[model samples]
Target: MGPVPWTVNSEIYPEAYRGLCGGMSATVNWISNLIVAQSFLSIAEATGAGPAFMILVGVAVVAFIFVAVFVPETKGLSFEEVERIWQERPQRNRGVAAVPDQKEPLL
Candidate 1:
């Protein structure tokens, strides 16, 4: 809904792969926007407004969880530091809890 996605996309990838990853992320973002915009009316009509809104809320919750777990915090960190944080993390522990000096993920 804001610049968070763009800002994160800019900071997260290595310089060499930034362009490719940024384009991919942008494509996915627009596709998701299109899907929701196109389907909201049909979904609401088919299921009623309360249920339709609830479905969107459920999706938002899932997305929040996914971001909290998988997205690294780049605040106050240099590009190399961000990369290092991700690289130092174990595959099994990619969540915010595993991030250095952070006990809780930003919400």
Candidate 2:
């Protein structure tokens, strides 16, 4: 996955929803992992794993295409600026804010 939306969303979203989003993201990741773990043997048996691997590759390709075409870059911009850009776009979904920069020295 890329860095843009993840960075943007974490910054701009309400604090309450941030944890929820994070939890959901983690859950989806774990679920996908579980699916892969449980199905790899079966997939290998059914289609020699080549087809299963190819399907994953295809899915990644499609996801990359969608992200490249639709997601905007957020690097080097403030969270608010990223939010403004997201809001201005008609086709884009809301993105998380960039994490705040710390100017004070660490204690």
Candidate 3:
């Protein structure tokens, strides 16, 4: 959960979109870190470090569920392979319409 959002965004895009997506993701990650660094001390002061971290733990749980449901296991998958994997899900379920399944391995 820790840094999962920070790390994963840059990894999931297709090869064609990776440059654009990676840049955007890096910006978002750094901005989020800036905001948290600036705000966390105040938040902790207003509501103790223990409670603040507990809230983050709850957020981590939610993030875990999100990843489990929405993120595919892309390990050992090429960018095209990962794209095909995600495109396997029904449009009704989420995201773009299912592309026709390829018979050849997605290298």
Give a tens-digit lDDT track for model 2, residues 1-107.
Answer: 43434554576544557778776766666777788789878887889878988977887799789868876776687767766775677333224445444799667
lDDT of 3 by residue, 28-53 (tens): 77886787788889989999999988
Candidate 1 runs further than 4 Å off: 1-3, 90-107
lDDT of 1 by residue, 19-95 (tens): 99888888888888899999999999999999999998998888889889888888888989887776677644655
Best candidate (score: TM-score): 1
Q: Runs in model 3 with CA error above 4 Å?
A: 1-11, 90-107
Reference-based TM-score, model 1: 0.77
Clashing pairs in 3: none
lDDT of each: 0.81, 0.68, 0.74
Two-way lDDT contest, 2 vs 3, winner: 3
Best by lDDT: 1
Evaluate model 2: give its TM-score: 0.63
Candidates sorted by lDDT, best first: 1, 3, 2
Give lDDT: candidate 3, residue 92: 45
What TM-score does each of the candidates earn? 0.77, 0.63, 0.69
Error of 1 at 37 (Å): 1.2
